[model samples]
Target: MQYYYGNQMPLRLLDEAEFWKHQEAEHTEVIREALNGLEPEYVQALKEWEQALTETHQQVVSYVETVNRMGYTFEELQEQVTELIKYCLDESLKFIDLCREIEANSAAAKDNPFAKTLLNHIIRESEYFVGIARIILYGHTPA
Candidate 1:
């Protein structure tokens, strides 16, 4: 009774914190089982998505640190901050698009545990980036 891409599917088990905890776990058993009968292309796409997520996360962190220690005159810091904000916005948009793509491709599939996990990670990382971006853009820490 496993569902595929085009099949109607049941509501996912949604225990927000627990679901995220499961995703954060290094246990690959669920992913391995899910991928056991899938196509190589899906596997390859999943790897690419994971790499993109990691790279984006690193870039956001580096940008935030750089902006924090800019140590420049007002005008110079302003310009640099503008550029950093633009970069963050672009990265955020890209991250959101990737999440949407993953959700669309895997939502109906019962064997998409890996995709689900990756999506959850991407979402959490994206939110983190957004928070940092806001702090940089607004000069105010979130309350």
Candidate 2:
């Protein structure tokens, strides 16, 4: 006797390639502008975070290359890729939180026109980054 289950929902694997492409195409320019408008300290923080991200990306690439050269099994490579994605997602969330903190503090700081403008830009940018972070972590595209 065959046990019947209700209508099965097709599981969609996270398409990291498509996600990255979309982010690069649609969000990079805004992020760049926001980074440009940040205060010095915030800029430094972003730079450091970006450096870490770059290193993580390089590590992933190296792992994939090594796996290809050394003839690792698909499962082993998938596991490594999953770990790298998790690490990058964690780092992205940390950067998002840092950006939020910077935005909040900047907004609360003394109000000079220039300072307010800068802070507003940071606030906007932080919100966007937070959305991106959520998308990366949860695999649900931001609306």
Candidate 3:
């Protein structure tokens, strides 16, 4: 997973608003592909969950944009992003579980690795984001 995304832009350099927009679009595409082989009816919950993710990403983007346009600091955006990371951390666990379930049920394509790859990426990325978010929002210290 690290090799896959190693050369990507460091999140620190990202314009939060633009980053969220790109991430949101990427997520939509990835999820669409991931659900490709699942039975249509079986994907309703997944579709709804994907939509909710989109909506949240949009909200975060909008908030960051507004903050950037004004002469304001990103303090609020930090809190918002922290919350988003927490939500994503939880969702990533569920996503991994659902993929495992689908694979166990033999509903997923055996030849296509797209869904499995996406879920693994989500899990690793979520863990990284959660760690970064925690460090930023509450400094990590040796306990």
C-alpha RMSD for every candidate? 14.9, 8.8, 6.7
Kindly indicate the candidate among 1 and 3 with the higher TM-score: 3
lDDT (10s digit) by residue, model 3, range 23-58: 544554565566567666446655665676666566
In candidate 2, residue 1 scores what lDDT? 10
Better of 2 and 3 by lDDT: 3
Ranking by TM-score: 3, 2, 1
After superposition, the stretches of candidate 1 with alpha carbons farther than 4 Å from their true spots are 1-71, 106-110, 139-143
- TM-score for all predictions? 0.44, 0.50, 0.57
Q: Write the per-residue lDDT of candidate 1 for residues 104-143, one digit (tens) a residue.
A: 6643334466666655665675565555555545655557
Q: Which lDDT tens digits does candidate 2 get at residues 1-143? A: 11131111000112342233233223223443544345666656655665665565556556645654786654555555555556655654565566456655653334445544654554455455445445534656556
Which one wins by lDDT: 1 or 2?
2
| Distance from true location, Cα of 133 in model 2, Å | 10
**lDDT of model 2, residue 102:** 62
lDDT of 1: 0.45
TM-score of 2: 0.50
Candidate 2, run of 10 with poorest lDDT? 5-14
Off by over 4 Å in 3: 1-25, 34-36, 74-85, 88-97, 103-106, 109-115, 141-143
Which window of 10 residues has the lowest lDDT sum in candidate 3?
A: 1-10
Question: Which portions of model 2 miss their true places by more than 4 Å?
Answer: 1-37, 107-143
